[model samples]
Target chain A: MLSDIAFLFYFFSLFISFIGSCIMFSKIEIAFKWIGILLIVTFLNELNTRFLVKSLSIQSNGVYHFFVPIEFSIYTIIFATFINLKRWNKILILLVFLLVIIEILNTLFLQPIYVTNTNTMIIESVFLVLLSLILYIRIKESTYYKNLLLEGVFWFNSSILFYYAFNILVWGFHNWDFINPPLIMYDINAFLCGLMYLTFLFSIYLNFIQVRKLKN
Target chain B: MTNRQIESIDVIVFIVAGILVILLMFGFILYFLISYKSKKRDYNLLEIQKKELDDQKKLLENTLSELRATQSQLIHSEKMASLGQLTAGIAHEIQNPLNFVNNFSDVSKELLTEMREDIKKNNIEDALELASDVVNNLDKIYFHGKKAESIVKGMLQHSRAAKGLLEKADINLLCDESIRLAYHGMKSKFMDFNVEITTIFAQNIPKIYIIPQDIGRVILNILSNAFYATIQKSKKISSDYKPNVTIKTLYDSSGVNVYIRDNGCGIPQEIKDKIFQPFFTTKISGQGTGLGLSICYDIINSHGGRISFESKEREFTEFNIFLPNKSNLVVKIPNNVV
Candidate 1:
């Protein structure tokens, strides 16, 4: 029953984020609309993870298999950089588009259909860390953009950090149980992903509100 | 792990998320309230300042109008003083001639009475000659006395105090009367010049609320300037370019506009602006006191009006006077009532 309530909260958050995206599209400004689109996509991706887990009967290993940490990390870095270095919008746009293409390719082709290997996880985790570092650098340099973008980066990066650290701990020190664990690490991952998507949605909403104020 | 343990963990996470969301919402509400309060305070301050500014403007306008009225009163007083002096001199001049007419007419009456008595007693020859002589003396007294009386009457009318008795007066009647009075007064002093006066009065002008005599004086002053300009120009140019003065009246949204234009050697552009200043004149020394246009300016301003002029050297000069209409009921009030 409690798990069902958490699922409901996650779904409610997704609904709000989707409505916020629609508001951005209704606005005339291109920058706000694009940021809103990015938030909706990230939320949808997170929602799909939960749906796949339930409908496909994807166990813990299946959960880790299909979802790539690299995608969120890259988006976080690109959005943070875009907010910070708007003067280089043309170059940043090109770079982000290329990274998205690479992410799609890797997700579709590189990893096996049902593998949960530590090597594959570490490789994806390293790319995420690199992306997080770039995002952190942008947040450090920007003054006005720091507060909002930093909140998004903090949620996403901390989630990635916790997931990777816990994984490493469980694999290296603790007895590996195939069926169940001492802690609900999967639930924690789900909660953190929900938080990351919520923060991203809030940041996009903030951008749209600021643009609307300027237009008025 | 039991199902109870999983439920407990889920409850803890859910409670924490709910608390965080409530806290964030509270913070946003607080921010909005503070911003709205500050903006309302700023708007109130601006409204107060605007009200204060409007009050100050009204006060300033009142003071300015009062100052103008006082200035005109001073000018009127000065005019009265000068007119009083002229009146004394004119009265003395007319008195001598009048006394001679009166004394001669009395003597002629006595002579005719004696002649009638002699004719009744049958002294025909002496009575006839005496009667003819009495008749000739009566004719002389009648002609001279009538002439002197007309001159004195004209002088009295010209020098009358301007009580500023505002009334609905016809502009054409006022203009013609003023020009006639001014010509009668000044023509004898300045000889050998035929000044052409033309009136281009607009037909069907509504009766304007103004002091007829005061406005007449203003027109007379402008005409005097035109005549002076013509005299000055005649010295340099041929007599063929005959001097002409024109008075025109028109009405529009801005009330009645009177234009007094002259084709005399126009005022120099440099001195044109100064012409309306008190005691500023281009006339030769001792010929003019130079208070004319200044008085005109004061009169028009007191009527809630303005006077402006345009002049081109040796071409033409035009003075435009704009007077507000009856809609300005406050200004239309008589001075005594106000």
Candidate 2:
């Protein structure tokens, strides 16, 4: 029962978080819409990975290989659009497109579709961490917010930094061999995924507060 | 242990080490959040304090304006009080010439009646003598009437300045009138006190443009002070200490200077610095308002002039007034005034 609970924990959290984001959809900033869409997609992906694939007795790692890059692409779009008013947005989007093509080739030629895309996932994590740190540096020197905690920009940037920084640990120590048990990896991934969704819910609620204040 | 289980331990150990490193990095983010929060709170507190100080300053400015209004009322009353002091002297000065005119008119009426009776009796020489006597009596009446008219006109000129109008006035003559009014006012109040007064006015001293009444008030205030000082000295001396007040007007290239000196109880060393300060007086309550010299100082300052004094305690006190008559006048002598 404990294992079952632990297994379904992150999926349930993502489902709830996606519903919350949709309910307050109109109140969120323009920069946060992509984040809301990312939540629903992630929730559906989690449902397929945790329930559908397991019920069919097939490999779930292949689904992650697809979902991970989609998530990284959305994050990159949001960060590039938000920072510097999208100063190098065209170049950044092109860079991600090139990375996606490289990732496809990597999956086909080096790792294969049935296994994890470790190289591309590690590269995505590096890019997200770098963007988040750049955002943090800008926030440190800014005076635009009455309270940073109530700002969607602050929450989105900081959460990216937090999750991706820790995520580097998972990828750095990934066990590719079938001889190793995947129990610890599953536990760490579920915990981090739950934490990330929780932060998303917080950002949505903070955006609601900020919208209400502006109306007043 | 089996080989598979040993391999899992190594994987767990490596992942946990990576997690430990990220945790160390997370500590810095936590510190940043805490320090930023603290700085924001301190800045908010200072903003509130600064707002409070601004409100306090505005309140203080309002209070200062209220005080200034009350001081203005006091100054007006001081001017009226000086006018009140001149009232008793005005009455005494007007009374003398009126008595002479009335007596002379009565005598002239009697003389006319006698001449009419002599004409009825057909006594021409005697009637002519009575007519001549009547003519002489009328002449006396006319002279006394003219004298009364001149006194009334002089008093009118002295008190005519209600709008602070600048006009050329004989400074020496104003000094004489102010002295007479101040002396008579003091005498009416203190009948037994007497002081020998003398005047040494300079010749060819042209009439300077001034608001005569304001300068008159300044001279009156000083002369009043001198009289009061002399009166106080008299109580102690009583036997042979002769009191004397002297007025001298002199003009050089600098300005017109009037020196008013009196042998009296002079200013004390302790209160000398406070002599011209508002509400500073040595006299007992109800005897003095203490605004006399302060008003005088302000009046002189407004005229682009200055007032100073010299004193020896219980010996003598002299006030020197230097009024700008040439280049220092802030006011122009109006085309009609000069």
Candidate 3:
């Protein structure tokens, strides 16, 4: 029942995020449109993974292994656009390819098909946290006239940093008997996903409002 | 690894991550608060400085307007002083016409008295002759009376303050009248002084737009100075030496140019540049206010014209004034296209 409630919470947040993206679609910039599309893909991924696990009796690990590389690659593009560092963008593309290769290697040799892809998730989370921190520092160094709270990027990147760091820290103790409680971990993951979606909804709304103000 | 060791490690790592998150949030909050306060303080400082600058600008504008008012008043008084000096010459000019009118009136009165006596004595032919004489005398009186009236009218016109508006003006008429007035003025002041004057007026010159009173003042001032210089030079030179002043006007596609040249003690090189400076004079004390040339320069400049002089020391000096024609006047266009 607890796991069902968490799943419902995440689905509700994702639905709200989808609605925000639709409202912001025509008014927002190209980069923002990409982010909105990324959110929609993540929502679909979650639904597909659940359908595969419950209805088809298939392991979710296979879905996650396929999704991680794609999800992180989208994140790489978003961060590359956000940070606006040319040299780092090329380096990030190379790193993303390497991460993809490593994820494939872990799935093939290190982790069984039925087990959780903890190694790939941990690596992805750590890289996302680092990129978010770097983006935060870049934004802080830039000249800004709007309030930090009102800035869409600030909230969006902060959500990424917080969610990924929390994910990695929690999953890092997967080897410990007391730490890897399956139900509690699932609840926590679902809560973190809902929080990220909520922040993304705020970011989309703020971006829409800002663009509307500029048009006026 | 043992279950107890793994659990301890997990708890420690979680505590450290949570601590890091707390510290980062606190740091961001502190930085934002400091930046907001600093920006607010800068905005307040800029507002105060802008207000102070505006106040200073207002004060400067007030002082500038006051100074302009004083300058105009001084220029008016200078014109009045010039009129005062011209009064003697004007009075002398009208004296001859007055004499003609009085002499003709006396002869006509005598003729009328004789005609009345002849009519009473029944001398009809003699009365008819006396009536013809009286008619001739009356015509002379009328002619001289009109001349005196015109002189008075010209003086009154010059004395009236300028309205400072551009109007259709005849350059030749203006130049001739000013020359006559200025010549008589100087001659009346210096009874023994004499200078031969010549005028070369451009024929069929179109009426141009000008502030008549101001331009009249400029012409009068230049003539007065030219006459003065020649008179002074004549006083020092031999009796055979003839002091001459020439006035010329040219109208063409380029513009209207007026040259007032005088054979006199020319302006020295060192003092030529200073000639248009306010209160600059080479005339003897009490003879000049030293504002005439400077005012002339300003009047010409204000009319979008130029005033310059060419002089040969101890020989001659000439002043040239060039006023651009209608084609050269600045035209203002509206912001919106038609």
Candidate 4:
């Protein structure tokens, strides 16, 4: 029953993100297009993980593993677009290319189709944590002296940094075979994702207000 | 270390570092919020300071207007002080014209009676001659009446508080008028006063632009002081000691120059510097408003001119004035103000 509520909350957050993305599409345009695409892919992945695991008798674990590398790569591209630091940004792109090659090799041999790709997920979570740190630094060092609470970039960077940091911890616990991870782990994962998506919606709203102020 | 132990350490390090980074980001955001609130407070304070400055500016404007009011009051007081001298001078000066009028009226009355008698006796030639004599007396009477009217008019102009404009004026005429007014005015007060006033006027001096009334006031003020000093000295001196005031006017390439010298009690050394200060008077209170010399100094400075004096105590005092020849008026002088 708890799992069911987690699932419902996850879909509710996705619905909110979808509405926010549609609003942003009509307004600020291309800045959020990639993020919207990422959310759509995540929504499809969640749907498949819920239904396909039982009905089609297909391994949803393999699908989750397969999609994780692609998601991380897409995140890299989005960060590259946002970050003005050309040197670090190019290195992040190179890292994405290397990560994709490694992921392909892991899926074919080390982690077969039925197995959970905990190793790759852990690696992706680590990279997300570091990248989120870099993004936070960029927001902090910015000369924007206006209200930080109202700043969309500040909120977005904070939400991502918080989620991925916890994500690294959860995936790391899965890596250690001896440790019996708590049942609440799944709930935490669902709640964190929901909260992250809700923050994204908030960021979009802030951007809209700022853009309207500028135009008027 | 074993491979398993190394893997565990790696997981531990990643989890710890991730938590630390999140904590640091939260710290940065809190700092930003606090800083922004403080800046808003400072901006509000700056707005209040601007409002206070505007209020102070209004207060200063009010003070400046009050200062102007005080200056006009001072000018009025100086005019009142000179009024007494002006009335006394008018009395002494009008006596000559009045005597002429009286004598001419008597002569005309006798001539009219003789002409009537001649007409009654049928002597037409004598009656015609008597009629011509009566007409001559009437003309003299008219002339004397006009002269008396002019004396009253000149005195009225001097006594009235007039903020008159600058114009082309003969400096010598101003000095002569001042000497007449001051000497007569002094004589009326002294009763038995007699003084020698010698004028050495230069020929064909071109009229310079000046505020005729203000310059008149300056000359009258100086002449009155000179006469007062002389009268005071005369009372203490022997019978042979004759008080003399010599007025000389000359013009050269530089400008017009006026010299008013008095062989009176010269200004004492101790009081010379204080003479031109407002309300600095040696006379008992109510006898004078000591704004006279200060007003004179301001008037000359405004005209782009200068006035200076030289004196030896109990010997002589000479005041020298220089008016510019060029049209370099600091204050604009208009025309026909007299």
Candidate 5:
């Protein structure tokens, strides 16, 4: 059942990513480029998870466990920095860089305090919540892409928040009875993230319309 | 998933997306460059057409001025030909009187000699009667001969043929002569009505190259209009009120300006625009040809100068003429070079 769920997730992500790519190809604006890039990255990550589940044995001790948080942190920081660099201050750049370096160092050097599946899930959830909060603040203050960009950020942040909260509650408290129903929660995140990508693409199209109107 | 697998997937996606973005950006830049170049070409074409149109307008104005000058020369030649015919008629009329003066003078001289011989023989009554007849015949010959000579002289001056030749001439003297010539024709009609003529001439105006006859004609036309306007107004008002006309001239750095003004029945606005048009007259049938102002307009235009007027109905009218000082020399230079 876990392998089947992983395959479905992988295919679903690929389908969403394909649609995002077509949107990017259609004379879209600059902001959507970032959203498209993020969607493709997530799709690849899901596909990799699907492959791992198919080829390898099901085990709590996975070699990729330590790399996930480090990879997530690096990608999020890079994307956020690129989009917000026009508003960049030296202090903000230094703070975000410091946080990324610390996360990387922790993933590379720190040993596990306790051997449990819950600990890994708890750490990942906490990091996702922190990243979502930062992204929400950045998106709220931005004026260039306006309502559509804000809608995108709202969907993306809420999806991440819900996923993290659901995971933490499901694993940290050992709530095994609700596990089957909550598996669908991951799909909900995927759907919401797809909607976020679509809204971001529409916002770019709107910007193009505005530019054409001004020229005439 | 293994860390190496995840890292490979991320690198592949990044590379693909980056390539797509670079290609799209290049396409946009190319489109913008093409649009900009076409807009610039359109602006340049519009500018060139505007310059060509301005050149055409200037050429048309020059052609119009030349046509006006040619027309005026033709009219002046026609007037001169008619004047020559009139002069020949006057000469024929004087010839008959002139012959009698010559024949009678000779006959009277012979009679005087015979009477002188008779007087020497002491015939007192016969000598007295013959002496009275000789005195009477001498008076007739002197009076008739002098009258014919004065008439010829007046005809010669009125013809203005000698004055038409270019010479260093005073404009003030020319104005006075033209006024005298016009008054000869106008005085009889205005004799019973009170009319005053005044002249204010400017001194030391440099001699200008012109045909004095043509200038004389312009002065005559303006003075005629002034007299007629005044006469018409006086008839409407009290008979005792005297009409006044003033002629004045001024010389400046640019040119000379002549003004003829009168306290008269001023031209109405409706007729003012048509005043210089040929055959457009306010006079009754057979009273005026209406070619006077039209001819004046043509003459001034040919001289590379202008004539204009101002009038307030029932109050006053002023005709202003400006003739450039060196216009003849300036105009000839261009023709000579071309």
Candidate 6:
């Protein structure tokens, strides 16, 4: 029953994100559109992994290995748009793409595909938090000082920061199996996912409102 | 993997991640606050610079207008001084003509009385001769009277404040009249003063478009300076000193040129450039206002013309005034004449 409730909460968040993206699709900037697309992709990834694991009784570790690196690349690209340094932005995107490629190769050949890629996930989470931190610093030092509360990207990065920062512990404990797992842990995990999607919904909606205000 | 190993790894990872998050959060907050403070400081500095620029612009505008007002005041003062000096010469010039008219009238009166006496004695031929003599004497009186009237008319024209308006002026006549007025002026001011004046006016010189009154003042100014210089030279050298001023007017396709040369104490090379500057004079403090040449230069320059001088110290000085016949005027001489 609790798993069913967690599933409902996760899908509910995704539905909200879908509505937010649709609302802003025609009016938002290119960078902002990429963010909406990323939200849809995340929802699809979660749906596919759940279907394969529950119905087919197949492990979703391989799916995660493939999806994780791509997600990192997309997030890096989204943040790169926020960076004002022209040459450095391209360099940073290229560096992150190369790193993702290396991690995928390591997972396919060196590590077993059946096992959870816990160590790599922890590294990815830490790296993502670092990138979000870099973005925070850049925004602070910018000459075109925007109010952090008004900016969609600020909230988006902050969501990324909090999610990855706390998820590092979950990745570390992925191998553990207690006799009776604490129900609260699963609920907390669902709550974190819900928070991330809600943040996405809010950011996309804010972008739509801002664009409309500018048009008027 | 054993639950013991997994739990141990989780404990270590959680501690590291927690510490890193705490440090990053602190750093980000600190940096944001500092950047905000710096941005506020930069905005304040920019505002101060903008205000300073506005103040500087206002100061420059005030100074420019004050300079313009002072310039017109100086020109007016110089014009008045020139008029005052010409008044003395006009008075002296009219005196000779009036004396001749008076003498001729008295002689004609005597001849008329003699004609009446001869007619009473029946001397008809003698009476007719006396009548002819009286008529000649009356003609003399009429000629002198007209001469005095012309002098007064010329002086009136000179005395009027200049309009500085360009017109088709006979350049030769203008120069001759200025020379006469200037020479008579110096003679009236100093009784013992005498200078040999020579004028070579080009005949049929095309009428040059000019501000006659302004150019007339310029001509008078240069002539007076030339006369004054020669007078000084004459006083210094007792022997072989013949004060002479020669004026020549020439014309070409380009323009009309007037040359006023004098045998005088020439301009020293050291002070040559300073001559055209306002308030610079070689004369004793009270004798000269020192604005003569500067005003002459300004007047010529305003008419799209130029005034320059060539001089050898203690020998001779020649001033050349060239007026272009072109219509493009650089300076807008005001039409209001006071």
Best by TM-score: 2
A31-144 per-residue lDDT for model 4 (tens digits) = 456677677777778778868878887778878666887788778877776676889878898878777777777788877768888777777877876887777566556545
Model 4: residue A20 alpha-carbon error in angstroms: 11
Real A-B contacts recovered, model 3: 0.03
- Give the per-residue lDDT digits (tens) of candidate 6, residues B259-311: 99999999999999899887798988666767778877777877878899999
Evaluate model 5: give its TM-score: 0.35
DockQ of each: 0.02, 0.23, 0.08, 0.13, 0.01, 0.12
lDDT of 5 at A29: 39
lDDT of 4 by residue, B50-94 (tens): 889989989999998887677667667668658677777777678
lDDT for each residue of candidate 2 in B54-108, tens digit (9 for 90 to 100): 9999999999888777666666666566667777777777787778778878887
Give candidate 4 regions above 4 Å deviation: A1-216, B1-11, B33-50, B155-168, B188-196, B203-209, B231-244, B263-290, B312-316, B325-338
lDDT of 2 by residue, A1-216 (tens): 545675577777787889988888788776677788888888888778768576888888788778877887888777775775556687678768867887888888977878888777777888888888777767766545667767777777777777777666667667344446445765766676677787887787788777878888
Candidate 3 chain A worst ten-residue window by lDDT = A175-184
| Docking quality tier of model 6 | incorrect
- lDDT tens digits, residue span B1-338, model 5: 88666556544544454345445434533453354445545656776898898899899989988976765564455455334433444455466668778877887787788788888988878777778887887888887788678657655654543332444556777777556545544554466544688999998688776555566667877887788888899889987667898999999988888899999999999988999987687988656656668867876775667899999999999999887776343221112110
Off by over 4 Å in 2: A1-12, A27-161, A168-190, A206-216, B1-10, B13-59, B100-164, B331-338
Clashing residue pairs, backbone N/CA/C < 3 A, model 4: B166-B211
Q: Give the Cα-based TM-score of candidate 3 against the true structure.
A: 0.56
How close to the true structure is residue B165 of candidate 6, measured as C-alpha lDDT? 58
Query: How much of the true A–B contact set does each candidate keep?
Result: 0.00, 0.17, 0.03, 0.10, 0.00, 0.14
Shift in Å, residue A71, candidate 4: 17
TM-scores of the candidates are 0.37, 0.70, 0.56, 0.61, 0.35, 0.57
DockQ for model 2?
0.23
Cand 1, B chain, TM: 0.54
For model 6, what is the alpha-carbon lDDT of residue B299? 75
Off by over 4 Å in 6: A1-216, B35-43, B96-164, B235-240, B278-291, B325-338
What docking grade does candidate 5 earn?
A: incorrect
